[model samples]
Target: MPMAAEEIEAMIRAAIPDAHVEITDLAGDGDHYAARVVSESFRGLPRPQQHRRVYDALGGRMGGVLHALQLTTATPDRGV
Candidate 1:
């Protein structure tokens, strides 16, 4: 069974409380999703590490219930 968008979002939100996330359904199949996450926590993490943080948020569901995730992560800009 594919994961629900809400479930996916909730998992990530729980892990990164200060994140700003946008979830999009790529194929309407529930298995493929595109997520853009902006967080202050990403300030120093490298690309691979940033993605790894999100993958970790999924709690090892990447290859099982969640098939594919196209992600774009960055640090949110504060008023400057």
Candidate 2:
């Protein structure tokens, strides 16, 4: 089954409590998504590491039930 946007946001929020998560369905198909996550927890992390954090929030659903996520992450102080 495909994952819902709210579910994705919830998962991220669960992992990064102070994160601001915005999820967009790129293709109007539950399989593709674009997520912009802003969080204080991302402050000192590099881009790849930040993405890794968001992925971890998803709990290994990235390539299985949820596919093709274009993710952009940033700290609250640094706009990306």
Candidate 3:
């Protein structure tokens, strides 16, 4: 089953308590999503590492129950 946007946001929030997560259903099909995650914890991390954290929050759902996520990460101070 494809994951819901709420589920994605909840999972990320659970992992990163202070993260501001915004999820958009890119295809309107519940499978392809675009997520923008902003958090203080990501301040010093590289882009790839920041994305890894969000992926980790998904608990291995990527490419399985959840697919095609276009992720963007940033710190609160450096909005993107």
RMSD of each: 2.4, 1.2, 0.9
Q: Write the per-residue lDDT of candidate 3 for residues 1-80, one digit (tens) a residue.
A: 88999999999999999999999999999999999999999988999999999999999999989978999999998874
Candidate 2: minimum summed lDDT over ten consecutive residues — where?
71-80
Models ranked on TM-score: 3, 2, 1
Angstrom error of the Cα, residue 31, model 2: value is 0.5
Task: Write model 1 residue lDDT over 1-80, tens digit each, in one string.
Answer: 99999999999999999888889989999999999988899888898998899999999999899999999998887311
**Whole-model Cα lDDT per candidate?**
0.90, 0.93, 0.93
- Native-structure RMSD, model 1: 2.4
Candidate 2 lDDT by residue in tens digits, 1-80:
99999999999999999999999999998999999999988887789999999999999999999988999998887654
Candidates ranked, most accurate by lDDT first: 3, 2, 1
Q: Tell me the deviation in Å of residue 10 in model 3.
A: 0.2
Q: Could you say which candidate leads in TM-score?
A: 3
Clashing pairs in 3: none
TM-score of 1: 0.93
Model 2 ranges with Cα > 4 A deviation: none
TM-score of each: 0.93, 0.95, 0.96
